[model samples]
Target: MAQAKGNALGALGKLTELRQRIFFVIGALVVFRLGSFIPVPGVNPEAMTRLIQGGGGLLNMFNMFSGGSLQRFSVFALGVVPYISASIVVQMMGSVVPSLQALRKEGEAGRRTMTMYTRFGTVGLSAFQAFGIAAALQSQTAAGGAPVVYTPGFGFILASVVGLTAGSMFLMWLGEQITERGIGNGISLLIFAGIVAGLPGAVSNTLGMASNGELSVLRLIMVVGLVLAVTAFVVFMERAQRRITVNYARRSGGQRAYMNQTSHLPLKINMSGVIPPIFASSLLMFPATAVSWFGAGHQSRWLQGLTQAIAPGQPLYEIVYAVLVIVFAFFYTAIVFNSQETADNLKRSGALIPGIRPGRATGEYIDGVMTRLTGVGAIYLVLVCLVPTFMQNYWHVPFYFGGTSLLIIVVVVMDFTAQVQAHLVSHQYESLLKKANLRRN
Candidate 1:
C-alpha cells in the first residue's frame, strides 16, 4: 500500500496531463457541491428539510443522489437523474426502433444522433419532473405545518421549471466536460461525488447512535467489521474477470513473420458496472415520487397505501427494487457487451478460442458463458443493493453503509484508479519512445 501510494505520487509528478485531469475533476466536483446550495426560486429550504426529517422514504434516496440538494430545495435537486432516465429510454428505444437500431450501429454519427435524442429527452423529463415537484410542494407541509412552497402559483411553477431544467442541463454539460477532460466517467463520478459527500455525516450519526446507547458498542463494532468485509468483497468481485484465451494464427515467410501468438479476451464479471443499481433506483424513484406528490394534494386510501408501499425499506419497494436491478443488470450487460460482436471482431483478427470453433460457434459459446456470468452478476448486484436496506432495518446501519450508494462509490473509485494507471503507462511509453529516438539519432 505504501509503494502504491508512492507510485501514484510519482506518476502525478511526472505525468503533467494526468495531474491536470485529476485537478479538473476535483474542481468540477467542488463546483457541483456548491451548486447544491443554490435553492430553487420559491421553495422553502427549511420546510423541505423538515419534510425530509419527518420520515424516511423516496426523499432520502433522492437526497442521497443529489448530495442533500433535495432537502435544500436546490435547483440541482433533480441532479443527473433526468439525464440517466433519458438514457434508459433512448437505449431501450434503440433496441426496438428499427431506425434507432440502425442509427446506433452507424458508429460516431449514430452516437451523436442518439446523444442528441437523449438530451432532448432529458429536457422534457426535467421539465415534467420539475413541474410535478413544484405543484406538489404547493400542498406539502413541514412537521411544523409550514408550506414547502412559500407562494404556490403559476409564477412559482414557471420559475422552478426554468431554474431546475437549466440546472439539470448544466449538470449534463458539466459531466460531458469531465468525461472529455478529466478522469473516469463524468456521470458516474458525479453520482459518486454525491454519495461520498454524505458519507462522513452518516458515520458521525452512526457513532452518535452508539454514544447515545441507541446502538450497543458491540453492535457498532460488528457493523464496522461487516461493512469492511462487504467492501472487500465488492472490490474483489469488481476486479474479477473471466479470461478466454485466444490463439492467433501462425504465419511464416510473410512480409512480417508472425509466430503463433496468444491473448486473453477479458470479460468482467460485472460488465454492466454500477449502472444496473443506479438505473434501477432511478426508475423506482420516479413512480414513488409521482405517487407521493399526487398523494400530498389529494389524500386517499390507495394513494396513501402506495406512498407507503414504494418507499425504500418497504416490502413492496424492496421486492420491486431487487427485480429491477436484476433486470437492468442483464439488459445493460447485453447492450454494452455484445458477445456476437466480440466474437466477430476476434474472428476477423484471425484469433480463435482453443476449444470453440470460429465464427457462429464462437459467438454462441461466448454468449453462453456471458449468460451464466450475467446471472451471477445480477444476483451479486441484488444482494449488494438490498442487503444494506435489510441491515438498515434490522441492524440500524447508517444509510451510506450499503446498497446502491456503496456499490457506486466502490466502482467509480476503481474506474478512476484504472484510468490513472492507464495514463501513467501511456506516459511511460512516450518517454521510452523519446529515449529510443534520441539514441537512434
Candidate 2:
C-alpha cells in the first residue's frame, strides 16, 4: 500500500511536468470547437438545418462524428474524414505497391514521407468533397424557395474548397501536436471530443421529444441502459487478450552464467480497435453524401440498394458493417503485428515460445495464434457494434448510442489511460536511476 501510494505521488509529479502538453491539447480542442460554429460564407444555416433534420440517417451519424460541424456547414465541416480516407488508400497501396511497402519498412523516415503523402491526399479529397458540397448547396432550396448559397459560381467553389481543405489541414496539425505532446491520442481524442460535444444536444433533444410526448420515458430509459451495457461490453472485449509465454536463453559473457528471462506476448481481442468502423463509415458516406449533394434522386434499384447496404438501422447495413469490421480487424491486425517478423525478431534475440520450434515453425504457430485471436476480436467487435442496433429495434429507441460509439469511447479511454501509466512508469524509473546515480557519486 505504501509503495502504491509512492508510485501514485510520483505519477502525479510526472503529470505536472506534462502540464504544458495537456494545455496545448486543451487549446487545440477549444479551437476545433470554435471552428465548428463558424459557418461557411454564403451558406444558409436554416435551410441546411432543415435539410439535415428532415431526413436523419447516415448524415446524422456523420454529423455526430463531426460534432455538428456539418450541420452548421462550418469551415471545418468536412472534419478529419479526408485524412482517414487517404490513410485507408495508403494502407491498401502499401500492401500492393512495392515502393510503398519498402517505404513502410524504412522505419520513421518512411513513415514521415507517407504521412506527408496522406496530407496531400487529404487536400485532394477535401477539394473534391468541398466542390460537391458547394454544388449541393447551390442546388438546394429553402422552404421559402431561397437558395442556400448566395451566389452559385466558381468563386464560391474556390472559397469553399480552400476553406474545407485548410480546415482539414488545421485539424491534422492539431492532432499531430496533441499526439506529440498530449496525454492521449490526438486524433482519437479529437473524434471523441466531437462526439461528446454533441451529447448535451442529444440529451436535450431527447428530453424535448419526451415533453412533447414524441418519445416515451420507457424508451429513454431503455436507451440509457443499453448504452451503459454496451459500454461495459466494449471495455471487457477491448481489454481481453491472449497471453503467449516466451523464454529468453541467457548466456555467459566471460565466466559468469545468467538465468533465462521470461515474458508473455499479449494479443488484444480488439486488435483493430475503432479503425475498421472509421474506415467503413467513411467509405459508405462518400457515395451517399455525393448522391445527396448531386440531387441524383436515388433512381436506380442498385444505387438504392447500395445506399441501403450502409444506411443506419437496416439489417443489410448491419450485416455489411459487421462483415467489414471483421475483415478490417484481421487486415489491420496483420498490418500492425506481422507474425513472421515477430518470430524472426524473437529468434534473433535467442527467445522462443515455450515448447515451440524457433524459426518457420514458430512463425506459423504465431500466425495461427493471431488468426484465432483475430477471429475472437472480429466477433467481439461485431457483437459490440450490432447490439445497439438490435436494442433500437427491440425497444424502439430513438437514441444513436450504438456499438461503434461505445467501442470507440471505451477503447480510447483505455488506451489513453495506458499511455498515461506508461509515462508515469518511465518517470518513476528515471527518478530511481537518478537517485542511484546520486548515491554512487
Candidate 3:
C-alpha cells in the first residue's frame, strides 16, 4: 500500500513538472488553429469554399488534411505539407546524389546541412505550389459570377504566393520550436491537430445525415464500432515488436569490476511507422489536385479521363494507393534501417546473433530479418489504411474518421505520450538522486 502510494505521488510530482511543457505545446497548437482562421488578403473566404467544392473529389481530401485551412484560403492554407513533401524529395535525392549522400554520412554537421537543404527545398516547392494555387484561384468564378479572388492580376498572384509560402515557413518554424522546447514532434502533432479539428464537424455531419435518414442509426452505430475496433487494433499493432536478445561483454579497467549485460533489441512490427500513409496520401494528391485548376480547356482529353478514373474513392485510385503504400513501406523501411551498417556496427562492438557469425553472415541475417519484417509491416499497413478507405468508397462514409487518419492520429499520440512519460521518468530520477544525496549528507 505504501509503495503504491509512493509511486502515485511520484507520478503526480512528475506531472506537475511536465505542466509547463504541456502548456507550451498547447499554446503552439492554439496559435496554429488561430492561423488557420486568418484568411489571406484579397481573397473572398466564403467564395473560396464554393471554388473548392466546385472543384470536387481530391481537393476535398487535401482540404481535410490541411484542417479546412485550404478551403478557407487562410494564412496557413498551405500547411506543412510542402515542407514534408520537400523533405521526402530531399531524402530520396540524398540516396542517389553522391554529394548529398556524402553529406548524409558526415554526422551532426551533415544532418544540419541536409536540414538546411530541406528548408530551402520547402521554400522553392511552396513558392511553385503557391503560384499554381494563385493561378487556379484567378480562373475560378462563383455561381453568381463573382470572382473568387478580390482581383485577378500579377499583384494578387505575387501577394498570395508570398503569403502562402511565408505561412508554410512559419508553420515549419513553429513545429521546430515545439520539438525543441515542448513535448512531441511538432510537425506531426500539427497534422494530428488539423485532422482532429475536423472531428466536431464530421460528427455533426454524421448526426445530420442520420436525422435526414441518409444514414440509419444501426449503420452509424456499426461505423462507430468499426472505428473503435480499428483504433484498438492499430494501438495493439503499433506496440507489438519482435525482440532479439543481445549480449554485451564486460570490459574492466584497473580495479573496477563490470558485469556482462544483456538486453533485447526491440524491432517494432510497424517499423516504417506513419510514413507510408503520408507518402501514399501526398502522392495520390498531386495529379488529382493539379487537374482541378484546368477548367475543361486546360486539360488534355486523356488527362481529363485520367483525373476521373484516378480520383479518390475510384476503384483505380484505391488499387494504385494500396500499391504505393506497400512500396513506400518497404522503401522507407530500407532507408531507416541499413542491414550492412547495422551488421558492421555490431561486428565492431563484438556482438553477433546467436547462431550467425559477424560481418557478411550477420549482414545477410539482418537483411533476411528486415525483409521478412518489412513484408509483414507492409501488408499490415496496406490492410489498416485500405480497408477503411474502401469502406468510405463503397458505403459513402466520411474518410476522416477512417483508418488512415486514425492510424496517424493514434501513432502520433502514442509517440507523444511516450515522450512525455520519458521526461517525467527523468524528472523523477533526478528527484530520487537529490533525495539520496540529502540522505548521505
Per-model lDDT: 0.84, 0.79, 0.83
Residue pairs of candidate 1 with colliding backbone atoms: none
Candidate 2 positional error at 386, Å:
1.4
Cα TM-score per model: 0.89, 0.88, 0.91
**lDDT per residue as tens, model 1, 1-441:** 764575566556777777789999999999999999999788788888988766444677778888989899788999999999899889888877899989988999999999999999999999998998788788888778788888899999999999999999999999999999998999989988888888888888888988999989898888778788888989999999999899998777768787889889888888887788877776777655555555545456666666677866678888898899889889998877778888999988999999899999999999999988899999888888887778888666665655777888898888899999998888788666755775699
Ordered from best to worst TM-score, the candidate numbers read 3, 1, 2
Clashing residue pairs in all predictions, respectively, total 0, 0, 0
- lDDT-wise, the better of 1 and 3 is 1
Supply the global lDDT for candidate 3. Answer: 0.83
RMSD of each: 4.4, 3.7, 3.4
Output the number of the lDDT-best candidate.
1
lDDT of predicted model 2: 0.79
Candidates ranked, most accurate by lDDT first: 1, 3, 2
The TM-score between candidate 2 and the true structure equals: 0.88
Better of 2 and 3 by lDDT: 3
Q: In candidate 2, which residue ranges exceed 4 Å CA deviation? A: 1-15, 55-57, 142-145, 208-222, 254-258, 282-291, 296-302, 305-311
